[model samples]
Target: MKHALVFVASPDDKPAYREALLMLGRVALSRKLPPPDVLSGWESAQWIYDSVDGELRQEAAAAVAELPVDWALTPVAGRKKKLLVADMDSTIINVECLDELADFAGIKAEIAAITERAMRGDLEFEPALRERVAKLKGLATEALQKTYDERVRLNPGAATLVKTMAANGARCVLVSGGFTFFTERVAEAAGFHASRANTLLEDATALTGLVQEPILGRAAKLDALRSEARALGVSEQDALAIGDGANDLDMIKAAGFGIAYHAKPLVAAEADAKIDHMSLEAALFFQGYRRGEFVS
Candidate 1:
């Protein structure tokens, strides 16, 4: 089947330069394919080669890797997904919300170590999250608002990816193991259709050190993908899931295009796709959308 080799580079890298495109074209030729369809933009490019087998695609992808760019080769069919599911901490935004919350409680190092272990798949997500949140006991409720205001920043291309996909009639959902407080704000900022996350319990003045029961962990993330796909009247194959932690594994595996976005080592190794060197907008390119076609 026909597949696309999508290459993206940061502005400083300029891997979409003329010579790089020429080299990519040559690489396609070496794979016994005609010159590729070059979907070049300011910072990325997509080389659509005709009917290349998976083995050939891998070889072509390896050749392109020598350049300062990231690439993904996927079947042409269903390249344009109708649903977008994403994780919050460390994936959509820069910092782990829990770790930031931990800082407010003066236990950032301890909580962060647990976070690292869980994200790396060395610890169970639900128990790990509960343990971490427990450490934040008695933290002022006001600190939640302050943390969101001062610490949270969207990852590059987050808005572009969500706005572009949602603008194109795709159902964009932010499903995070993080708290609903952050997901609500993030969904609004990034233009997602809806958001779902764990609810952090709090009293009048401070956190109760408890999250609502049945913590939304790895399994729940997958369930969100399935549920969202059902609500959107689409199958799982028409969806794209992106995240950076072990909790994102099931959802990533369930979606048609599961991307590990600057992920932990375990996730990066297992996801169907990965984006280590580019922004979330590269997900659009992975679906064969040209740069000009992006809605935002």
Candidate 2:
């Protein structure tokens, strides 16, 4: 099959730094492949080559491992997906909403520890979430808004990634195990077409310390990916999924192109590609979109 090896660097990197690494990448890839198509001047590029299965991913990784550029090897056919399904918490936003909400309850440390374990796949997601929400019981619902206002910020290139893909006609959806309170706001903030998440049941003034039944966990995330794809009249193979936690693994694996964006160990290990050195926009470049074609 014909494949593309994409190299992406941080947009904030100095010109000299970007140029030096891209130069190294060109030199390394040219030895076994043709000259690359520059996706972004000195920032991103792609080298197309014919390979069986993906024997070249490891070779390409070794060639550029010493440099700071992030790379992805994907088949040239169907590189541009029709749908984008991304996770919320640490994937789209900087901090976990639940953890920040816990800060207002004076239990941020305890809640954050459980969050880490859940994301790392050490504990069951549904049970872990229930345990965390249980601790936030009796807390004023106003803290939810406070957390969004003070602690929730999109990760680098998040808006650009979503807006660019949406402008190009892809249906983008934000699916999360986090509460709908954050996902709805985040979906609007990031310009996603729609969003899905678990709901936190609250009383007139405070949280009831309970979540709606049938929580949106790992299985739910995968279901969202498929259902969204179906709504677009496409198969799961026409979708692109990216996330950073163990709960995201199912959808990540089910998508045509699965990406781990600074993900946990298990997710990073199983993903088709990982964006460890670049921003979220790296996902765009991996799909053969040029920098000039980006919407934001």
Candidate 3:
């Protein structure tokens, strides 16, 4: 099978780092393939090769284990996907909305603990979300806007990733277990085509301390990916999904290319690729995007 091993460096890193990575990659592949195709000067590159032994990912990892570069080794056929389904909290955005809301409720530490455990796959995601939101019972509805205005910020390269993909004819959707209050704003802010998330039930003045039934958790996220792909007239293999939590596992595993963005252990273990040392722009590099072609 034909595969492309892509390496990405932090945009802020010195050019020499990627140079060293290219040299290391050349040695690792040992002239089996032509020199890498540079996607961004001293920032990203890809080596296309034929590997029939089926140990491609391991070989690629071993080749750059000592370096600071982040990488993805995937089949080259569907390198550029037609649909992008991304998780909001801690993936597209810098902080977990639920945890930040917990801060306003004066129960941040406690709520954040459940969040950590749930994301790590130590607890069920749906119940965990409910438990966390329940703790915010009676909190003013105004806290939602406060959290959005004061705490939420896009992770580095988030906008570029979404915009570039959308510009190239892909449908980008932000799906989260977090409330729609944040997902709606985040989707618009990040240039996503649409958004889907749980609704936080509230009265005229405050939270009802209860989320709507049939929470959008693991299964729902996967459903979103499938439904969106269907609506786009594409196969599941024509999609890319990314996230950093256990709730994202189903969709991540189901997408043609699934990436774990600074994820918990379980999620990282199952994802097709992971971004640890670089920004979300690494996703574009993995998809063979050139820096010159990026929208932002």
- Tens digits of lDDT, candidate 1, 1-296: 66787677666755355555666767776767655555655566665666765476567566666666667878888888999999999889999998998888888999999999999899999999889888888999998999999999999999999998888889999999999999999999999999999999999999999999989999999999999899888999999999998999999989999999999888888787789878888888888877888776
Per-residue error (Å), model 2, residue 123? 0.4
Candidates 1 and 3: which is better by lDDT? 3
What would the per-residue lDDT of candidate 2 be over residues 1-296, giving only the tens digit for each residue? Answer: 88787788765666634664556466546556666778887678787777634346666677677777778888899889999999988889999999999999999999999999999999999999999999999999999999999999999899999999999889999999999999999999999999999999999999999999999999999999999998889999989999999999999999999999999999999999998878899999999999889887
Which residue pairs of candidate 2 clash? Answer: none
Q: State model 2's lDDT.
A: 0.89
lDDT of each: 0.85, 0.89, 0.89
Give candidate 1's whole-model lDDT: 0.85
Instruction: Give the 10-residue window scoring lowest on summed lDDT in candidate 3.
Output: 15-24
Range of the 10 consecutive residues with the lowest summed lDDT in candidate 1:
11-20
Q: What is candidate 3's CA lDDT for residue 27?
A: 54
Separate clash counts for every candidate? 0, 0, 0
The predictions' CA RMSDs to the true structure, in order, are: 1.7, 1.9, 1.5
Per-residue alpha-carbon lDDT of candidate 3 for residues 1-296, written as tens digits (9 for 90 to 100): 77777788865676645664665566546746666788887688777777635566666676677777888888888889999999999999999999999999889999999999999989998888888888989999999999999999999999999999999999999999988999999999999999999999999999988999899999999999999999989999999999999999999999999999999999999999999988999999999988998999
